[model samples]
Target: MNDLELGVIGNCAVAALIDRDARVLWYCLPRFDGDPVFHALLGAPKDASDDGVFAIELEDHVHSWQSYVENTAVLQTELHGKQGSLRITDFAPRLFWRERLFYPQAIVRRLTPISGSPRIRIRLRPRFDYGASAPIRTYGSHHIRYVGPSATIRLTTNAPIDFIRDETFFNLRAPIDLILGPDETLQEGVVETAGRLEERTTDYWRNWTHRLAIPFEFQDAVIRAAVTLKLCTYEPTGAIVAALTTSIPEGPGTQRNWDYRFCWLRDSYFVVRALNRLSAVRKMENYFRWLMNVVASLHETDIQPVYGIGLESALVERTVPGLPGYRGMGPVRVGNQAYEHSQHDNCGNVILGVAQMFVDRRLLSPPGHEDFLRLEELGRKALQLYDKPDAGMWEYRTRASIHTTSSLMCWAAADRLARIAGHIGETQRAGEWRSHADRMKQVILERSWSHKRQSFVESFDGEFLDAGVLLMTEVGFIDPHDPRMAATVKQLEKVLGRGPHMMRYEAADDFGMPGTAFNTCSFWRIDALARMGRVEEAREYFEEMLKLRNRLGLMSEDVDPKTGEMWGNYPQTYSLVGIVNCAMRLTRSWESVT
Candidate 1:
């Protein structure tokens, strides 16, 4: 029996990283956020004989390789056997309607054989809702239906397939020709193939990607990074999720797992900044509108650090049992409880993003004029808590403290409010805000800095270096070339820096165990260096940071330098924004130097 390792069975979706032997190693389906239907990536199933898992086992296959089409989302995997070669292409069609109005659509996988006569096998096992539900599969002439509570998966195969109760198995020889279409038509409860779905999907990406006017240097990498960022966005809410999947371990079995499929206020701001650099205003404008909506709906004291795709205010975290985690990192969790915590930087982040839009793009009058009122209201709330203790940028679940970074953000919020108020002719309010901002700046400089250490501390009472200090320059709190700013950067590099990246801060009782170095902070260091005229150092560090991107030019929340594996969440939005910002900064620097 030839065991092909490249078979992927996702919850109602089929995906795989095909090997030379035509075996699949990684795949999840139905929705990118859905649970594993075939979970071999985590661990082997208890009952391997059941068809409920999709995998390929072929022995004699020689070589395999995988690649994505340039500047596109299509993934292609190829396998070479003694007799011939086989290729598989995978992509999800971009739907016409927005996510709120339409059900999640289909994922298309196409297989073609190019060489000698070799036998191939295919299996599909689907577990729904984080592998908590097992769907019942019913076979048809051209399709197979897997039905479970309120959700239905229909698979259409161009070639013949052998059907089992909850799985589908099939075999093909070299010169194989087959098209696999898996649709998750949950609300509608029916799946149909349109005459021009593929054509439209290809066209959608081609047109969308072409809008990015990127420099020729590293053009391919830049486009892929841009596309990856787009995939992480929740179209309906204009909220970009931090990543596609959660619970992928930072280390082998460390409990550092956290859910990342929700929108973070901080990440949203960076997303806007990144998109703004590309002159892609529609998405950023939509997000700004979403932010305005959030601010409008929130009570004075009920603003959260994060929200869901539907703008749900509550996020109760829960861990799933029975199913093991990715790479044996147990206790996979869904829903983030951090929503209840106070992240002081969030309001400041929002202010900074909007201010950047106004200053850089001249978007003084966004489409919905009412959004300015919402922003003003939110700024007022943030001002009220300027002196209060709360969670800082890193959501340490404990009693609030006057985190230095938080205080800095408060200053940022005040500064932006002053500018915005001035722009809108709120002369009296603008004056008050500016006065308040000056006071906050004075407070941060006085209380947050540690004279003995000659650097800013993490909290008012602590004497530790925080990676967040890198932002002092980025946020314009201090000039990058200032001796004080230079000293702080030196302190962070000496204390928190791990190789090329920097840790958030030293581990403390308030925050959980500090794990790997954060990727965003690493880029922030590059940004700081660039702003300080350390152009060569910034360029070198930026290139080193790019090495952390996965095969798909995607980045995670953190990384284990020793192993080079992604830690924390996969494809973090903040990380991508860092990449975009760093690239743009480097390009700008080059233009200036020339």
Candidate 2:
């Protein structure tokens, strides 16, 4: 059965998820927010050879082993059979060519026999319009073109065209390379192009990872998390998408699924900040530019929480007609409605996301006085709406509340603006922003504190517990030694703990109670525990959370704490960010690395 146990392979331009048996399950064509070409991650309804997958099946298959090539996004999945074994090397070519980054909209797979003669069948199916239509296929001597409604994809392979077309088993006597890319013909032979690109792509990734100032311990986990977050970024615009897949449900048999393929301002804030910790500032500088465009285009308080990676705003949510959801769950969705949400925190997240650029000299293009004036526009909105009602960070659809998370982020925006102004010798402006920040912080502490429950609550006068309150400590709003900080942590554990994982909150929403623990919140709990002087306990929980990763050391959006099964969107950026943040917080200093 297909699960979230998949390895991701991609350059920044395009990404695909492959299962342990080397099935290309989920691949979006052309771009990250584009149509899904291979939709097997969300199963198709009509099963006449299953219309939305690409796979290589070995005869009498017995077992499979899969992993990423070390320090790289390239994936190698080896299938073992009674007769013999074979390996499939999959990657998207990314390297510097002709003095510019050359990452094409292509996926390359090389198949080689590792043992005695093995027989295999190639299943290359491509769908369009969210699995609503199958592409019309036409082939030449060495390539096949899949013509679709919006785009055309070409499959250029070195294997026998008749064998692939007839779906017949063939003896794996020699190596074959399959290049799935644009409709244009290749300029070189399949073997030559694939070989040069594969070697260069591997080198590019290893070189990138080598530069990261990783944590002394958990180096492997941190490297994988860093790589995964880098993959989430859209290089052309610097917008980081929340995840690769669209409508994987948060839990089983629940209508909690939402398309996470778009860029969320709140999520992008965390992603850029986490990468900045590893000394990878390109994403930050790039994302800062993206944020500037987003803020500049808007007139006033009309900003959105989410948007297309290409900076297109209006993401109208709708369900498609044909494809079944993941694991036979229905209602496959395409666009997201969160763009229409009054998240209220968008201004603050954007400000916080790019605040480092104002003060850090390491950036190539630092924000100037004009940029600070632009950021001040967002600060004004943050202060105006910090006490109003809106969707919280979790984006609850049915209800709007004066969320503490919203208020806290607004405070963070103001606080950071004060720091930035002070850094640039604007003392008067610094004092004015500092006054606004203090006022919001005092109000949040007073209104969000629930004396009845003796802990910080989700919203004003609310009694329900939420894991988001943990950010009070994370964002440096609350002193770690404060008694309420301890009380809030203790109360959260009492209410939201599910085995080793932690739920986002205890309150039921439009979908009733959530059934799974959010993966990011579990890591937040570990961060809170480590800060509360429970280092040993936090270490144990961190170990448990690391065990939650799928075989490729990857995480999704949520998990069934009862079953230890992943259940949300594949390769969530938020969940992966947690891995890097916690590793940085929990590891010993580099001074002691020797």
Candidate 3:
């Protein structure tokens, strides 16, 4: 079966997922939202084998192991056979050159035989435009080019071009270098370029890891998660994609698949917050600039739930009929229509991400008066929409309700703006923002609380339970010690919790009941439990959640509560953030080790 124990290798420009046996199964070109150069991950059920895959196969393969080179996006897979053993090192070249980041839309694969003669076959079948067409190939003495409708990629390698073109096996006598990238030919020799990039990329990542303030416990896991998050970020525009691939269903046959290639304001807020915990705020600072551009672009328009990485506003979602979905699940999709939905909490999330600039002394360009004025515009929108009806964070398709989580975030926006105002010594503006926040809080307390249900409800004056409101404590909407919060947690778990996993909610919407538990909701539950002094229980539950991760310590958007099968998009940013946040919360302090 196709699995997500897949290792990811990429620069911020583009990424690809390689399976345990060193097959490039999924990759988007030029940018995160670009067309799939490799579509094997979404291969049809009938074609179970590598249909559109780029793989290096060892003859009579017996044993295989895969891992990242320490603190780097480079992936190493060791394959052993009875005759010999070889190592495959894969990475997308990203390193500092001439005092700037040199991240290209390229992949570098180096094959080295570590033992006796190991023969291997090269299968490079790249599909284009979502597997709708095959590339027309042409070759030179040292390179082969695949030209498709949308893009063209060149394979520059030291290996025999005829052998690679014909998909034949050859003996591994010496090191072979394959650089798949833009159609242009490289000036330097293939071996020299690959060697230089591998060395510099290693240094770049190790330097980055050295600067992070990771906790002593689970340092490897934390670093891996952090690296994955960084790989998801599109550095050109400072937009971080939720995941590299789209149409990986939330659960099997649930039809809960949605495209996550675009940036959601709400998700970005959590991403920056989690990275900030590790003292990695460079991405956050760049993201702040991006958010500023996004907010400025919407001079009069209301903020949407998601936007294109380049801040393109219109994302009319549609299914790609040509490609079967992941594991032959149909309805492969692209372009999320949630961009058109009215997710009122969006303004609050944008403001929250931007508010970080005013306080972090490390930032070179902190928020000035004009920045505060622009934020006040978002604050006004939050206050205007807090009590209004629209889709909540889950982006329910069929209905609209006064979601309590939306209101709480609006309260957060106002609360933070007020604090920001005070920090700038704008006492009058501070008081005004505070008054708005207070009013929103009072209304939320009055409407969302359910005395009959003995808990806070999902929506205003509705008794439905939602896992989102369990974040009341984490977001500072309510103290964990408060009886109402405790009651809400208890009732939420009763309704949504299955073992250690928690469903986002219980109600049906555009789809039927969710088949898998939303991973981040459970992590939020862990945080809430920790804040409520259920540390022992929280630790036990955290361990349970950890078991749900794949062998690589990676998670998807959701997991089957019964089968523990990972579902939804692979290496989801929200899921990764959950891992980092929960680890930081539950791990013993560094001083304890001292």
Candidate 4:
């Protein structure tokens, strides 16, 4: 199956969607950040067809359909047969202690018969380190071992599994059980099997969903988006990844692939805002603490745009030469190089996130935390380079430019610095930062806005419409109803809007290359319209964009308008945040109208 054709299956505890052909397309084994055990999706190796590392044949099945139990993450898939039906329910349960702490590892997939008893076949192929390492497997009663370089996977099945050369295959006519544990040694039949695993998974998700302060009319969509966002989070660290799978191409047959498994500083900012909107302020606060910890340990100059789940800074980009790119997009790469790029927007993002934490309704003060001091020092450093050209928010591959949106972010950083100083009674420093912020605003207004075009240009000299301009109102750089914003909105509509969806920009006109239409830009347009009191238009557009979510209510980085296929990385945290933020804003706007 193609990338877009893959299906998803999993309960809130643990769920994975097997394709129509029976390949585990996406899964986070042991923990969400653990290296992939089956990563054929990245790309097929040169020896894939011959060596059979990347190819797996599916059993002939009549039909298949998958769904989650209502308000729960427990996923159920029914496979039809000539005699009867085979059903599989998957979940990864949260083992809460007396303290109710969350554990990170454990994925359970249970297979049973739902209708007339039919024989079900199962296969276990374990590939470690993004399919680069092979493990030594030893099998015994209800237990199997696959040892690798850094980690070991112990597979246990309730039923007998036939051992092949390296893979395991078995047939079951009755209910069978399976357990996959990572990094831990396993004893035969050692785990206490919960008779009500499925029920517990259902209750876990239902209770979690009940906590959401959902006010939107489209309640289901909002809940699903929120769940997808939760699924992408690294619960232990409070770090949210950009997406689940890596190397999902942005364009067909292109090398615009990236590994999004790591947490991005920019994404955490949005996660905080989204969780706060759901009235789950504690989680957001935990993330703020995580951010504080990250910044506190690093020098002001050592701050990176992204970091590993453990806050590791050694993110050297390297390509897996043997593995082909996803869907023939060559050169599967891991470890982002953007970490090394001079993305000035990160400082602004950190400042904004910190300011939001203080301003949020559920505010908690981190006593004696050095992170805020470090962040303030970095903000000051960023101000020193306010006029120097640097990579903008988009992180374009070419030379840096004086991007207007990035400059606006710098203005936001200084503005927030001023606010933070005022909160701490540092009036002198606050005034200095306020003066710097005013200077940036003046420079942006003078150099970024184009009177001839009657809108804000993409950069200092480029004459084009950039959907990022919509952020001006959101970031408080300009009034939402300002005439300049209206003109910019008009320009965006004329240039970037394709029906109800919006592109990041006219890629051909500005970025010099065409790309898939960005999904988040659509949300920005909705926010802009709602802020401008275009309530009716904003509601209509918001509803229209909601139609683009996948059957599982997940969204990618971009979309293919003609085919309605989600492109880019799957389950993108930014897209989910956009959905939640826009929906919340739209709901509030509608309330104002009523």
Instruction: Report the number of the highest-lDDT candidate.
Output: 2
lDDT of 1 at 14: 25
| Model 4 spans with C-alpha error above 4 angstroms | 5-22, 28-34, 46-60, 163-171, 183-198, 298-300, 360-371, 424-429, 507-512, 588-594
lDDT of each: 0.67, 0.90, 0.88, 0.70
Cα lDDT tens digits for candidate 2, 1-594:
229889999899999999999999899978987888898888875743387889999999999999999999999999999999899999998999999999899999999999988899999988888787788989999998999988999999999999998889999999999999988889899999999999999999999999998999999999999999999999999999999998899988897778888899999999999999999999999998888998897784488999899998878888876777887786787788888888777777988898889878887798899999988988998989999999898888889999999999989989989999999999999999999999999999999999999999999989999999898888889987699989998889989997679999989988899989999999888998899899888888898999989888999999888888888887999899999998998998869867
Clashes of each: 23, 0, 0, 11
Candidates in order: C-alpha RMSD to true structure: 4.7, 1.3, 1.5, 3.4
Residue 28 accuracy (lDDT) in model 4: 54
Predicted candidate 1 versus true structure: per-residue lDDT over 1-594, tens digit per residue: 111222221211222333333334334554444455555444444444242354443235787776766656666777676666667666665645554222244555566666665445666665665566677777776567877675666766655645333234333452222233344332321222432444555666777788886754556667777777777666656776666666766555677677776778888788777877777776676676677777777664577888875677777899877567765567787788889998888878877767755544556445333655677776776677766788888887766678888878878888888888787777998998899888888878888788887898887766877888788887888888888888888888888877788778875634355667789999999999899899889888888898877655777777876666677766677888888888888865345654
Give the per-residue lDDT digits (tens) of candidate 3, residues 527-553: 999999999999899889888887777
- 176-293 per-residue lDDT for model 4 (tens digits): 6666665454433433453355556567788888999986576777787777777766666667677777778776765678888777887877776787788866667667767777
lDDT of 4: 0.70
lDDT of 3 at 374: 87
Error of 3 at 78 (Å): 1.2
Sort by lDDT, best first: what order? 2, 3, 4, 1
- Can you give the lDDT of residue 38 in candidate 4? 64
Q: Using TM-score, rank the candidates from best to worst.
A: 2, 3, 4, 1
